[model samples]
Target: MQASNSPSLTRSQLATELGVSVFTLNQWAVSGKGPKAIRVGRQSVYRREDIDAYKATISSTESTPAPVSQPIGSYMMRLPEVLSLSGLSKSSIYAMSKAGEFPASVKLGSRAVGWPSHMVMQWLNDRMGNVA
Candidate 1:
């Protein structure tokens, strides 16, 4: 079930809530792994429900004394974080992008590139649904 108290979160906030380093989140985005995020124009946001679901899945698999209460969403990740989150290699991300199956990165500057963090998360969710 979704957490009613969970609130929309930015990539950085979600990363903190997940206890994952920002670097990790970026990898997930670039690699096309992790949870689905949303784009509000140039800003990115993650749904609290999605974060809670992901945490539940991960926490349930671990052999712990008890599960802790976690915020549904509270972080906002960058492209590098998504790449790490997804575990897809750079080439793989590029290939997926070329095929239009993965979220495409934008040219941030002359040499900088980035993807929508929320979109990367969505791709991950889609993959999970298909696998199930």
Candidate 2:
């Protein structure tokens, strides 16, 4: 049964509306991990209003910075990794780094910088020993 009042979308149509690749939408559907969808054989269908509702539900989530995953054997650590291993918030990390109280990050490229792994590890060990 179709609802005449609400607009609906095919997989490609919804992917275009969301500005994501069709494969991504398909993966989401297959994994049951994204906007609600109906699967009829290989085809997936979505309601425009449902997509909008899904967007609203996720609108309040905090946007984590890029490079959320740590690279294996990475010589340098990005902000996410530092926070995970150091138990410090973004603001505290930056404030301490600026104040020269924490290990400073090194320039990796024109727009990217990271902390040396050894230095961060040393800082962690030092912190553990010093804290009461």
Candidate 3:
């Protein structure tokens, strides 16, 4: 990982890296259900560093995620990404979402869902520790 200070991704950019439809990401943002994002004149931009920090945290769980030598940012995640990251399932994720226990989904179009990658990760972190 290169030592830098700045976000490497726009909202659209991060979605592509994570392999999810853009509609999903937008939905997450609109609903206030994704990672902390900056609203730049009607656009959301996710910081690369934030994503990396989140990954580093999840990887250090008590169960200790399996060692995979991939750059943290290289693994952008979506709903399926969240399931795979925490070893949860689709139904479980939805249930949690409904209960407002997990990151909420943004509303994209009439029927689309997306979660903020960082928000999901941060939720995991707060779960792992007494985060403020």
Candidate 4:
């Protein structure tokens, strides 16, 4: 539990500060790898000190530089490829696409659709909090 006087950040604010999406933060929380959080009523909050310590740990352990941005050319990714890269179920992808949460697929032919490769890579980078 955090002290009552400590400053805290909401999940959304922390995600923005870390250059990642809220969904990514949620995944981290579930995996038990993110900064510790304190529950405040219905919300989860991160103490400023905890966030700072988490960043320090990451910076100290990471040896490689951040990933570069996706290449300039556009390429299409079929469903199987998308699933492999994203680790999301086909239904989740379609549901997220329909809800405008995930990138929409492009129509390749009468019955085929594919996602842009660059977009998928960008999304993955964003989720990994790798700014490029």
Best by TM-score: 2
Give one digit per residue, the lDDT tens place, for model 1 in 1-132. 123355887788878777798788778777766667778898667788777787787778768577634346623455578679899888898899999989887677887787766677788999999999
- Please write out the lDDT profile of model 2 over residues 1-132, one tens digit for every residue: 233244777887777767799999879877876689977788778877788887887776747769645445648889899999999998998899999999988888999989988789989999999995
Q: Which candidate number maximizes lDDT? A: 4
TM-score of each: 0.41, 0.48, 0.37, 0.45
For all candidates in order, the CA lDDT equals 0.75, 0.82, 0.69, 0.87
Better of 1 and 4 by TM-score: 4
Model 4 Cα lDDT, one tens digit per residue, 1-132: 333345888998888777899999899989998889888999999999999999999989989878746577978899999999999999999999999878999899999999989988878888889544
Model 1, stretches more than 4 Å misplaced? 1-79
Worst 10 residues of 2 by lDDT: 1-10
Q: Would you list the rank order by TM-score, best first?
A: 2, 4, 1, 3
Q: Positional deviation of 102 in candidate 3, in angstroms?
A: 0.4
| Best of the two (2, 3) by lDDT | 2
Comparing 2 and 4 by TM-score, which wins?
A: 2
Native-to-model Cα distance after best TM-score fit, residue 129 in candidate 4, in Å: 46
| Global Cα lDDT for candidate 4 | 0.87
RMSD of each: 18.5, 11.4, 16.6, 14.0
